[model samples]
Target: MNAERLVRRMIDVGALRFGDFLLSSGKRSRVYVDVKLASTFPDILEMIADGIAEKLSGVEFDRVACVELGGVAIAVATSLKLKKPLVIFRKEEKSYGVGGDRIGEIRKGERVVVVEDVITTGRSALSAARRVEKSGGVVGAIIAVVDREESGREFMSLLKLSDLIKAYDSFDTTKS
Candidate 1:
């Protein structure tokens, strides 16, 4: 799916909002992209998966890893599309259940690609990558549905949805 189409669809589904908002990074912003809203619609979720899978077409990865909370659905869809295993990393290791920071199986030395919904500081994504590395998995890349045009480009390689954000901004301006 093209960025323009995805942007318009996100707007229609109320996934993209404008106004003052506090971000997870403790910053204020005029625009907020709540990709979690898209999870309610299977079609949109599939579209997102398709878009991400297309972007990763030539990339080599043994597994798709997602940071907990936001990245789960998209990662699941992408994993299904690419026919790869899905690995989930939580913010912290759980004391109960499997009793680890990760869910699902990831073999040591396996190449992994991380998926995220929106990236502002890239802290969480980087942290997740570190966790994967600690688990002996190689982090190949980090992909996000939206990048807030903030910091975090220095250390990590990020594939972002710039065209989609541009389309959304243009659409918002026209509406205003």
Candidate 2:
């Protein structure tokens, strides 16, 4: 997948916005990328999944675990593209039903990759990873759609859309 093309598409779809804004982390920012909106488009979602899958081509992971809400769709697309099973992690354990925080069959000691839409504080992804570890699964890596360039907690290994961001800045979408 072409990262530049993906980035341009994200801009066209109003996923990336430039303005002074407050973030969920309570920080001020000049740019905000709502990847959830981008994921709503099947073509863009497929590009995102393909990009992530390509990045993880050689990486070893038994399952793709996604945090609740934002990461759900992208995770599903990525899991399908990679032909790997998916595990969903809730922000908190469900009160009803199975009464568990996680949904899906995850084997103990299985290697897992955490997928997320955006990484700001990195808490959501980290929390998901912690849950995986607590459940006896090993977290191999964390993948996100955008990094937001915010100084936050770093993961042991992370794959982000840095190249895409650079492309967005350098490429002129008007000419295309």
Candidate 3:
């Protein structure tokens, strides 16, 4: 789980893009990190899982939780690697068939770590954490693959926006 290599891989796969984009959190930014793209490539996904697993070392957690969509693959891979139970929070509460806002159950007082593919304002990850808390699970930590740095919230991240920019610059330089 080398950071540089991971950034380089992201660059190669076009996961990191620079453009005017609107984030799910409703923030506008010139940088858009599409880690979901990594999910389509098993090797890239594995690398992310490896990096996340490495970061989780020494952190005590009973369940790994994540919001639906972007974080699913990363969370599933991490859960598999760490042998931890997975709890997935839905984007919205289900209206039918055992209606609920989440999949899997969290035992009372269980320590949970919320995972996110990218964090801008940290809304999605924090929302998932709040859900965990409401379900009697303690949010031990919040982790992300990339942090846009637009949000002042503190969270563990495998890469930062600056790191990606640096990687992109280096990559572009080599290409020229």
Candidate 4:
């Protein structure tokens, strides 16, 4: 399915909600996109993975990286769809472990793409980008399920990591 249809389903499935809401950035928002359903539903998740994989076509990326939690499944799916390796960025460095809070299977000078389930202020993705860059991964792009028309996209651009982000209206739909 296309992004439009995905958006319609997200709204129908209560994954995307419109209201006055407080964001993690301590900012108020008129919209909130919760995409757990899309990541969990087989058809929908495959659609999302396929869409993202298509976007990666012709792009030479050695690995796919995703932020903690939400991005985990999506990144894995995308990697599977593209037959590429997957790595996950944790919220915090592990107190003790082999790859706790690691940049995910990335080596110095490896190519990477950051994935997220949603974006609002873009802080999380930016933070993850820094870790990836600092660890020596060349970030190619940022992918999100929703843009939220907020500081998220700008934050990525400001960081100069990647202004290249892709999102669909799937998280913003009418007739809910």
TM-score per model over all chains = 0.89, 0.87, 0.96, 0.80
The local distance difference test score of model 2 is: 0.82
By summed lDDT, which 10 consecutive residues of candidate 3 come out lowest? 167-176
Q: Between candidates 1 and 3, which one is better according to lDDT?
A: 3
Show where candidate 4 strays beyond 4 Å: 97-99, 152-176
Task: Give Cα-based local distance difference scores for all models.
Answer: 0.81, 0.82, 0.90, 0.70
Pairwise lDDT winner, candidates 2 and 4: 2
Kindly list the per-residue Cα lDDT of model 1 for residues 1-176, writing each as its tens digit: 76667778788898877799999989998887888897668888888888888878888999999988999998999899999999998887899965987889788999999998888888888888988898899998888877776864843222244555567777776565
Candidate 4: clashing pairs of residues: 7-170
Tens-place lDDT per residue, model 3, 49-93, is: 999988889799999999999899999999999999999999999
- In the predicted model 3, the residue pairs found to clash are none
User: What's the lDDT of the predicted structure labeled candidate 4?
Assistant: 0.70
For TM-score, candidate 2 versus 3, the one ahead is: 3
Compared to the true structure, candidate 4 yields what TM-score?
0.80
Candidates' RMSD to native: 2.5, 2.9, 1.2, 5.5
Rank all candidate structures by their TM-score, best first, as comma-separated numbers: 3, 1, 2, 4
lDDT tens readout by residue for model 2, 10-120:
878888777898977788877778889999999999998998898788889999999888999999999999999999988888899779888896789899999989887
Q: Looking at candidate 2, what is the lDDT of residue 140? A: 87
Best by lDDT: 3
